[model samples]
Target: MPIPGNLLTTAMAVMPHTDPERAIQTALSLDIPFWPQLPKFDYTEDMYVQASEHFPGIVLDMTAKTLRFSMDKFLAEFEETMAHFDDPAYFDISPAYSAVYHRFLAMDHSKRKAIRGQLEGPVSFGFNIQDQDGRPILFDDTVRPFMFEFMAKRVNVQLERLKALNPNAFMFIDEPGLQFLFSAMSGYSDRAAKDDVGAFLDRIERPRGIHLCGNPDWDFLLQLDMDILSLDVYTNGEVFGSYSGSIRKFLDRGGVLVWGIVPTNMEPFSKESMDTLEARLIAIWDMLAKKGIDREWLLSRSLLSPATCCLVNPDGERTVEEAFAMIRTLSARLREHYALDGD
Candidate 1:
């Protein structure tokens, strides 16, 4: 897939705002405006719960704020759920799941470079939701296939809706749980997870992307057949920069790397300025350039974002707002410095 033109700045999935209007406005202010997943406004906006709306056997406990799966419920409703697998409306995300999705769709996106939407990845969703017997649904043979298909359909419907607003629209899968793939305690092997992710990616017909907030196996992730790879450069720049070979190969294949350099937390956000962050990002680019990757090419095939979603913070939405401001400013400065005004 060809990289979207002029995708210099965007954001992760979740936002900290309780006001839907404010969240939508904040998203629309970016170079690549995205539909904000406002979990603070409603429990249904939680990524796992948001994606679970139509899935069979999944139960959401509003009082306890937890999710669990029931085998008996799955067996009872599996056939009916599979019957409408090809229907796009069956997997549509209603206003119940997102407070601002409909409002976002009604906005004017004509001037935006690109638009983005996101969902919880299968690996993260399966690992987070537990069965009645206290086992992850990912490890369940019967439910895993359906879960993957369900997520694929959901992405398709959302992507279809987004494309109507702007042709350059795309969706990314949030996989913070990817960090556990290689952990001995996870019980899920890295090879198995890779194969699972590949299979899931094959089902989506549009440009595919994945975002991980933690420092996962960089080599393993960069080697995947994805259009974009987003990571937390604010905290993991040193380790991620060490994977110069993988980064070079990924870029050579027309992959766009979303360098999430802005900090989302108050403590880190308070300690850095636009000048310092720009220097930090440039140092990493210089390191890669010394290893044979061109600096100009790196800037061309790159996007900017906060390190991760800002859902939990002491200062609430103010921290996330500041992070967004810094990235937008940094994007303009980088464009000027690299003489990329034509892009």
Candidate 2:
């Protein structure tokens, strides 16, 4: 499936509020509703927290929302866990998972193209999670491969649940931490990175997308066998533009470009109206179109989203709501101009 005309702000400001009702409320309000990831709604729903389900010998500090592992014990149990990776006990679909998903199950689907679900990408998961020695698992020879395998299988679990609702279930493997891939670790080669990421991408039978907010290896990501390459175009649009050849090939091969054009920061959010943001996106698109890319092809293969998740102020739920409104407004403006599908 191509990326939908529906807004990809599906994972927007779901933190800082613990009420399941708020997640449902937010999803209900979207032009193209999506399941929410409300870690604040349930600490257990935090990206790493939820990933802890398959890792044995990992200590969960609910108070701090961190996972600690005894390296020896984790490896000792590795074989046993691998044998039962498909067990229902390995994936915890609870609290916010049910809250957001149940609402999606009940949604009026006649007009919907697909459902969007999110998971922590293997790179980001290993980067964020630590061992008892406070070491990031990404750099660990013993644990990193295991983490990658664990996350790869975790996707299978998520897909099974999502496919039950919508066959065209789209999973956006959020990998914001990939920007640190080179700087934060040594001995991690592009080939190694490809293998690590490919482990998951190769297994996704349904359409899959990758979302990265920071400047990453565009050349590497665009060539992946994935459906969508979502980026923070509002901030890094020029960076991506520098790789015209690769971008052209990606589009030529039927990959979708999810233009993350809406600003997630407050300063830009305050200054830009829907018209201005739409213009920004058009300018970028026009540049690409001029480079021998077809305008209609680009429009048909693109999606609009905020550059990043909206940052929520401690007392500013309304501000978050406004951010979502801005995304929908921009999406509406794009649809008006492109005649994109939205019902």
Give the number of the best model, judged by TM-score.
1
The candidate maximizing lDDT is 1
Per-residue CA lDDT of candidate 1, range 269-329, in tens? 9999999999999999999999999887777789988888877798899999989998988
Report backbone clashes per prediction: 0, 1
CA RMSD per model (angstroms): 1.6, 2.6
- Could you tell me the TM-score of candidate 1? 0.96
How much lDDT does each candidate structure score? Answer: 0.85, 0.70
Q: How accurate is candidate 1 locally (lDDT)?
A: 0.85
Off by over 4 Å in 2: 5-14, 92-111
Candidate 2: residue pairs that collide: 18-41
What TM-score does each of the candidates earn? 0.96, 0.89
